[model samples]
Target: MKGNTNKIIWLTGASSGIGEALAYELSHKGYKLIISARNEKQLILVKEKCKYPENVAVLPLDLAGFSTVGNGVKIAIAIYGRIDILINNAGISQRSLIMETGLEVYEKLIIVNYLGTVALTKEVLPHFISKKSGQFVTVTSLMGKFGSPYRSGYCAAKHALHGFFDVLRMEHDKDGIDVTLVCPGFVQTKVAINALIGDGSSQNRNDTATEQGMPAEIFARKMIRAIEQKKYEVYIGGKEIKGIYLKRFFPNLLHKIVLRSQYR
Candidate 1:
């Protein structure tokens, strides 16, 4: 594994879950981290927990506020001089039927999950290109590869990220830019509680499988390893993560299996 010592990393959604865990893990490993999230308090807590607290910088940010990300990027770059990696881990989930979900609900999901990520990535592209070296690590979900019931909009946003970032990799590969798309099936995070409901309100409740999902710290470790190897795409999670392959190789069989699966 390549040690990330001295590498400048910009991580979004660092308030909790995998982002927070990754902040500590990477900082401990000697990476200079600039962590961002909407919750400044939680971001500070993440920094405080780092084994190398001085290596972590908390830059609280709201991805939904696309216009302000440029300023955030500027501040991060000013602090670190150059960013070697950008981890787009900030996103919200949805748990509502297509018909039951309001138009506003769909808009909010797409705007925050897809548009916000795209805006921030665009903001940092010039710097990466000029440096002729950088990595874009995105934390998409299994929903990105296969759609399930009650996650119509969430699926759309994740799928769009693949389309956009795949092209980015193709176009910038020669420029020393690397893109790693991480699709995890599920991990014990507050994703379900923060998920948007039919009326666009937070679910504020945990789902069955998610409650027993993989630990965020372990997920972050695997993610970092994948990023170090520059894998174009990697799936991290439990048995359910294999569905990505089953869906591709045996669509009909996967359909039947998923139909009987409890996750849906």
Candidate 2:
């Protein structure tokens, strides 16, 4: 009824990692939540962990299934009549060099990461437009801002989100629609383990950098603060966030660092 209190928040990829942390964080702040993910079992577990479990709804969704996301959003909306925020935090990562990766892997990454997010956003856009008030929060990566080895396809997908959402923010400013692009460098999660490899198979291995990344709970806390402030774009991470600035001022230096990274 005041500020973010009692607002309805629809969050995707809510079963694990940053999404899971956010569920708890937002629930404690008194937001009614719709949590979605591919795994219903895990989603239920996340829901039960929330401070206000009764305020949460679990909707299982697979990002790759484009046609299904629309229905997912519809179900989410029915829970609270309207949704004040939609968080597009669902996506897959790549862990193979472009040359080693198959075309199908790139296609799959685009479908699940780029197109899937777009489809869901489009589904929710009409609702926001009708209300003339809503916020869209997308979780991209530090990789979105620059090129990185072994993540060619993943980088492409994230870059596409930046382009789409930047345009959306501009076009919908008069409609009072807010967009936040979150660029996270690394957080201790299973992302590396679940990243797609050359054949579209999971890498199943965690990179050393991922092992040394920020805790997901800490990242979620900062993210919630950014959302509350309605920042257009926010970066979170360790030294990796500096890459965004480095790419702007010292492109050659950042390129060299990327080439020398353990990724290669």
lDDT of each: 0.91, 0.92
* Model 1 Cα lDDT, one tens digit per residue, 46-116: 89999888888889889899879899989989997999999999999998888899999999989989999
Count backbone clashes in candidate 1: 0
Model 1, residue 138: displacement in angstroms? 0.4
Q: RMSD per prediction, one decimal?
A: 1.5, 1.3
Number of backbone collisions per candidate, in order? 0, 0
Per-residue lDDT of model 2, residues 1-264, tens digit only: 234666899999899888999999999888899999899999999999998899899999998998788888888888889999999998888999878999999999999889999999999999999999999999999989998889999999999999999999999999999999999988999999999999989999899999999999999999999998999999999998889999999999999888888453
> Cα lDDT of model 2 overall?
0.92
| TM per candidate | 0.97, 0.97
True-vs-predicted CA distance for residue 58, candidate 1, Å: 1.1
Residue 118 displacement in candidate 2 (angstroms): 0.3
